[model samples]
Structures are given as structure tokens and as C-alpha cells.
Target: MEKRWLPLYGNNLEAHSTIENRSLTDLLNDTTAKYSDNTAITFYGKTWTYKELQKFSEALAASLNGDQFKKGDRLAIMLPNCPHYLFSLFGTFRAGGVVVQVNPMYVARELEYILNDSEATHIVILSDLYPLFKSVRDKVPTKKAIVVALKPGAEIELEANDCLFESYLKQATAPAPAITIEAENDLAVLQYTGGTTGVSKGVMLTHLNLVSNTEQTYDFMFSGEVSPPPNARIVNVLPLFHIFSLTCCNFVTIRHGGNQILIPRFDMPEVLETIKKEKPFQLGGVPTMYVGFNQVGKYKEFGLDLVESYVSGGSSLPVEALEAFERGTDRKLCEGYGLSEAAPVTHFNPSFQERKAGSVGIPLPNTDAKVVVETDAGWEEVAVGEVGEMIIKGPQVMKGYWRKPEETERTLRDGWLFTGDLAKMDEQGYFYIVDRKKDMILASGYNVYPREIEEVLYQHEGVQEVIVLGIPDPYRGETVKAYITPKPNSTLTSQEIIEFSRKQLAAYKVPKAIEFREELPKSAVGKLLKRKLRDEELAKVEAEQSS
Candidate 1:
């Protein structure tokens, strides 16, 4: 009988002593062994069974002549969510290559930089994105072979120079290699993150880092419970390039043996249509997704009748958005906090327990979390319920940032990953996020978390999207400003939005001014690029203040 990991007294219980220890690659083998006939991936009416996925993955590995690349050689994969994406990902791992995950939406400049920086010798991209790569492929030093995936939802146009993915599968006949992979501390993924600070850098996650985090999230959700029906379906819309979706939707779903319905894009109507058809048991989304879904007042159109859980991450879930969703679907939205550096997920609200509306829940099982104060005397753990830098030390913490030893040392100290996020833990162990250290808005000697202001703006019916930022204010040092994108066809004025927000937000927390745009700029992974918006807003504010 397979040993089951159970929660002890609502806390995480250690099972390292009971189970057969294995690496991530080994875990994949076990999944294939148990769920060979089960459906592993479903997209656009196409389903790949676990057996078929395993076979194709091994075949692709064999065909790659993977021995050519060293054990930790990086293979950059730039493609959207598709069957080939999965095959290439697994195949690269099976071939003993580190998967350098790249967002498909990246422009030439971004793509070229990552390619050159990582020294990625081979790249697998989508057909449509190939043209963009061709623009800068010559400038990148490490790119040698460019393998393009056939564009789905269109007629096959196999160029003479381009090798069809199907042809490679035909050439691969050998089984996957059986190797004792150095998985514990070896780099498995290089996920890139960018912000106002600097250029994008790869977040190095090890096999144990990813596996531990996935298992932690899975355990928190109580996946594979006894009383509840075991077979469940999860709606996955966030891009897999993002750590949040990659860990929760893709990796954890595999462990839970849950069916994942992948939607390449988050189109409101299409998502609702799919939901009505599939009646998924769980839905995972960011704040933007939840807000958009709530705006689709035709909530009845979505078959939310069967949904048992809804998880939110990437950003804070607004109270109004959660309430609206709950009112319409009767499903509570559980919000959590994590970053790309920590294998994406560290803490989450217990799926079966009482969920606090504004809090981001407690730490994961087996993970130690503490708020530490930083001073000249060095770092010291702060008392409970005190706001400070949140630090985590566990198997889930990444090995370090790739190639940047200085950064790795700075981030990882004394077995603890010093996350730059600000938070406080309550008496009950529930953690509440204060804000991002870099995102703190200094207004007249006061520090404000933009999420607090944004939450108030989200309560307005006409507000479609809102991003609060700090603008240079000579008078007060800094002033709270808002950039809003209202609902389509809605004639909400900036003054009206400001007035409505003023009613709810504190005087200092309220926006001194507001600007309305058609849409807010977002990262390729669907995260709101507040830094970009802030830079633009700061320039505009500086110009106005100078005049």
C-alpha cells in the first residue's frame, strides 16, 4: 500500500521517515507508473494519457542525442502552453538538462538577453514566435539550434528550413535513460523575474526545491482526501512561465492526480464558457482574473455549482472581488503569498479550514517562517505579531539565483531565505502580508502598501483595473497616486473614482490624483507591472510639479 501523508492536528506532519525517498525525475517515473492510463494533459479537445506522455518524453530525449549537453547544460524553452511544451519540458529533464523557462510573449530584446546570459545552446519556440526570434537570433551568442513547434489552431506551414516536431518524434525510438540524477541540490529550473530594480535574472530552483514546495501546497489543500470524492478538476489559466501557476496548477496537480483544464489566455467569456462546460471543482487565479470574472455579471452562465475551492495568488485578492465571486458562485477565494525565488508557493490558507478574508494564511507544513528585524547589530527574530521582513527556511527554498553568487549569498543566509516581502504573523499563526519592501510608498513620513488603496478602488463597480503607486511630491515628500483602467463602455470619470475611493481609503492612503487608461501594462506572465507604471507616472508627476 502507498503510504499517505496526513496532517497532524491541523499542522504539517513529517513523513520523510516513512516514504521511499526519490528525486523529481524519480517522482515523474512514479507518476507514469501509477497513472499510465490516466489523462495527464487536456487542451483544445486534445488529451495526452500519462503512458503516451511518458513514451513521447523518453523518445524526444533519445532523439535529442542529449549526451551532447552536460548534465546541467541549460535548454531554453520559449513556447506557450501546449502538449509540445509539456513534452519538451519533461524531455529536457529526462535528458539531464536544466530547463530555462522563458515567457513566449517576450520581445526580441528580452529573448536575446536571456539566451545570451544563460548560454542556452538550443531553443524550442512556437512557430508564430519564431519570426520575433529571427530578428535577434544572430545577436545572441549561445543559440545554435532553433527548433520550432507547429502552430496550433492553424494550418501546418512546415518551412523547408524548419524541422517539424512530428518528424523528430518519428526518429526517436529508444527508451528514456535511467540515470541516478543529482536532483537534491542540482538546478532544475531557471525562472526569470524582472521589476523596477534591474534587468531580468534567472531564479535557480533545484529539484528538491520544486518537489518540496509542490508537496507542501498539495498537503495544504488536503488533496486526495478520503471523505470527499478523490477525482477533482482544477482550472488553470495563469501562464506556466509564472512560478505560481507552474507550482500550483501544473506541478501540484500532477501529484494530486487531478485533471487540469488549461486555457492559454484568460478571456472572460471563454473562461466562463469552459467553466460551464467542465464544471471544475477548483479554480486558481490572480487578483486580475478574479476581478474580471466578477465583472462578468452573467455569473450564472458559468457553472460554478460544482466548484469546491478557489485559490488566489500573484497579488492580493481584493475584498470586493472575493465577495462578489462568493455571492455569485458560493466559493470562497483563499489568498496566499509567495515569490518566484521560493519555488513560487510557501504559504496558503488551509483548503478545508476557516479562511480569513484579508489574511494570506499560515506557513506551509514543515516550513519554518519568522519575521526578523534588521539593524546594525545584524538580523534578529522579531516578536510574534510584529511587522518585519519575512524569512523562510525549508526544503522548498531555492538553491540560489543562477550564476550570481553574490545575490545567492545575500538571499540565502544561515539556511534561511530572506524574502524582501513585509508581513506579520498573528497569535493563531496566520500570516498577513504588509507589502513588498520595494513597493512601499513613503508619503509624509507614512508608509503605505498600495494593495490597501487598490483594494478600496476595486470596490467601485465601474473600476475594471486599478494599480496604486507613489509619485514624487515635493510638498509631502511623496503622494499616493492611482492608475485605473475602467470597464469597457463604462463612462466612469477620474474625479468620480477619486471621490469614491476617498470615501473608503484613509486620507494618506487615498490617491491625491488619478489617471484613467484603456489598459494597465502587464508582464508576460499576467502580473501587473507596477514598476513600469510607476516609472511612467513618476516622470509625468515630475514634469507637472516642475511647471
Candidate 2:
């Protein structure tokens, strides 16, 4: 079999090369040694140099070690992007512990499941979220919790055993103790992603997996049309909890000795102002953020042109966004593709090569990707340009789902990670994502599983049958809409269900629209056909677009 993309490789990128085995700590270590004085992270009014970042990480590590945080202990981080997030990450790695990524917006019900399932004994959370954690504290196994208050003089009442971040860091000043880390076998992070059934599955990523992916990302990107000098200031507003940002933005930037400006949340005016003031060379964001910029429609005034490189990930890039970027800024918006299973990144449209607007360019070095169709004979590789399931084999692939053997087997087959993403590879080896095989909805770059919402709606006595699906929205790439069959003589309003879901689930997971239906499309076996509902929605979207 010929590697069609081999021809497109530049002099800098090798089609195949030996991936160096290392740990995530080296990303900071190597850079800190060379660029200690370079600014590493900037959040709000505070800034940290590489040396300060390492010092804080070591301090946090010492605090954890002093508090009996042993190797392999799961430490859940439930805070948004801030300097504290970086400290927690490196601190955990330095302590030879595993970092579990948890969304900060999780409601009490959703929060309890992740903490208890991961068996995380320690958690570093924002002070604003203390009440939420306090509500579920008794339900989880967490023995220690550190609360960080970003606001000045903000008071958060804590348990007697719990402590404030400032207090915790006071004791983290000693030298980091020696601990052996087996990068290949030892788990470094547990990235929780939604399973097919809407259950949360913790993706077990080894240090080697993250390290290899970081290196691959660097070579594939820097060895291209993008050749930023070391310590270049970078704009990073993507939430650090997400795999896309964690690996691509945080890991890659720290390793590259770059200064990253962190924004806690997206506010268009604030973002534009930051870009104007900071004048960073590059920015990484999702389609929603780019669309936000597109909505502003003021490229030159806000200094959007100051940034040299703009990359999009986390979800599909609306071609409108790409075109809007080009029209407004005369700069290309590179869209990449990846999933949490493959340490989150497998393909990126290169800047050095013939950049395709719709295609997620070829696989990274040493990564083998194939689009295959499952038939009675077995899984057969589909011809180029044919849509099929994208499967990948690479060093960057994760070990397995944490503690879920059956789910592990289902996703990983023989050394290949089965990505349930519908895609087709061009003859030139560029891959294009057509749709998702699973009923996962991407709303504003967040994965909203239909089964999870249906399961929640089922608990409501007013709902007899329910189906959730994604619909086209101009703002959100896809907005969730629920088709619900009410119980006889029951009245349920969209507002009522939305309010209920807002209390139980995260804001993004809640359905934005609801429709009362007499019946939903079903198969001959009377099984509710989600695919049919999706098809109908797509048809409706198509009709709307045409009109």
C-alpha cells in the first residue's frame, strides 16, 4: 500500500521516524532550563515566567507530597483556564500522580459521577464552585480539596479539613522529591469522554502518549509555513480542561517556550481588546470563537491582523468561518482534527503544504490512518475519497478507558483506535470529516450525547418517549433539539424542561429547543430510530438553507 501523503512531506517532516519516549514534565523542564526568564503564562493581572511557573509547580507538588499525595493518586482539577491549572497539572506530574480533567461547569449531579468514578481523592477547584462541590462532598471519595479564589477578597467557607490554595502553596516550597515515572506504562492523565451510551469513560493517557503527541504536533506545525521563534507570545483562550487545548495549546506552548495569554471565558469585546494589547503572534480557538470574531466584523480596528496564525479545533470549522477569516483578515484559518482517544490530535492541515479549506490534512509522523468499512467479511479498507470509519494506529494512541475493559475493547481493536467518526481520505491523503458515527452532538465545540439527555428526560414523568438530536444553527455549529412524546394528558413546555435540565446538567448539555411530538420515527421492531430523526432534521436544515 502506497502512503499517498508521503509525496507531500516537506524536507522537515519525515513520513516515518522514531518517536522519542519522554514524560510531560520535560515539556516544562527543557524549556525552563533554556528560557527561564521568558514569560510562560499570563492570566488576568498576574504573569509567570518559565522559572516562576516551574517554581509554582514544584511548590504545589511539595504541598501535595506533604499532604500524602502519593504516586498514581488521582487528582481531579475542576477549574477553568488560569495559572492555577498549569500549576495543578505539573504538580501532579511532578508528584507522579494522574491529573483528571473535569469541566468546571458541571452541575452537582454530573460532578458527583466523575469524582466518584475516577476515585479522585484530591481536587483543586475554584472558590466560586465551592458550594457545588460542598453539595456533593459527602457523595464523593475526595479526601482533600483546595479552593482557589480568583476574585480579590472573595470569601468561600471551607470544611475544617479543606484549605485555601494560598494556604496549600505555603507549604510547597521544598525540593521536589525523587519519584520514578514510567512514561510508557504509568498513567499521567484520565481524560473523561462520553461513551456511546452516554456513560462517562475516562481515557487513560500515559505520559509517553502525551509526550509523543506533543513532539509530533511541534514537528508537523513548526516544520511548516509557521516558523515562530522560541518564546513567541501566543493567544490561548480555549479552556485548558479540554484535550484539544490541553495538548495542542498548553503542552505545545510550554514546550515551545512561548508565553500564553489565558482567558477564563469568552467575551468578544474582552478578547478583541486582549488581541489589540497583547499582539500575540498566534491564536488557537474553536469555531464558535472564530465565529465570534466573524460576528464582530472589525478585523483592522481590533488588530485581528496582528496575529499571524489562527488555528481551529475542538469541532468542525464552518466553511463560512474560514471564508470570513480570509475576507476580513486575508489570513488562513487552519482547521485540525482529533479525538480524546488519540491524545486528542491526529491530523492538522499544514501551513507549508497545499492547504485545503475543508480537509484535515494528513496524519502526523508515524501515525497510520485508514478509512475502513465493516462488512460480513470483516473490516476492509475503503478506497480513497470514500466515506468510512476512520481508524488510526500510532504511538500517540491512549492505553485504554480507565477501569472499563468492555468499552476499551469496543474502541480499540488490535492496535488500532477505532474513531467512530465518518470521514474520507483524498488521494493525496488529506482527510475530511463528513459526520459522526455516534449520536454525539457538537454544540459550540462541546460534545452533547443524545442518550444522556434522553436518559434525563425519561426520568420526567411528563415524558413518555423522547429523542434528542442536533440541528443546524447559524451561531452554534449544532444546537440540540429534543423530540418528545408527552405522557397522555401531560403538558410539558420547552421552558419547563429547559429549566429542569439546567439544574441537573451542564448548560451546554441542556437542550436549546424542544418539540412535542405525537410519535417519533421508529423501525419495524418499534425501536426508536435516532438516525431517521437525524435525517429528518438534516432534511429540514437543507430545506431551510435552500429557501
Q: How large is the C-alpha RMSD of every model relative to the true structure? A: 11.1, 1.3
Tens digit per residue, CA lDDT, model 1, 94-213: 777788888776656567878988888667777777677677777975544445555545544543344556666566556546655666767878988643343466888888778888
Task: Give the poorly placed runs of model 1, Cα more than 4 Å off.
Answer: 1-21, 142-162, 173-176, 223-231, 439-547
Worst 10 residues of 1 by lDDT: 1-10
Candidate 2 global Cα RMSD: 1.3
Candidate 2 lDDT, 168-210, residue by residue in tens: 9887656669888889999999999995699988999999999
What TM-score would candidate 1 get against the native? 0.77
* Model 2 lDDT-worst window of ten: 15-24
The TM-score measured for candidate 2 stands at 0.98
Please report how far candidate 1 places residue 409 from its true position, in Å: 1.5
By lDDT, the best candidate is 2
TM-score of each model, in listed order? 0.77, 0.98
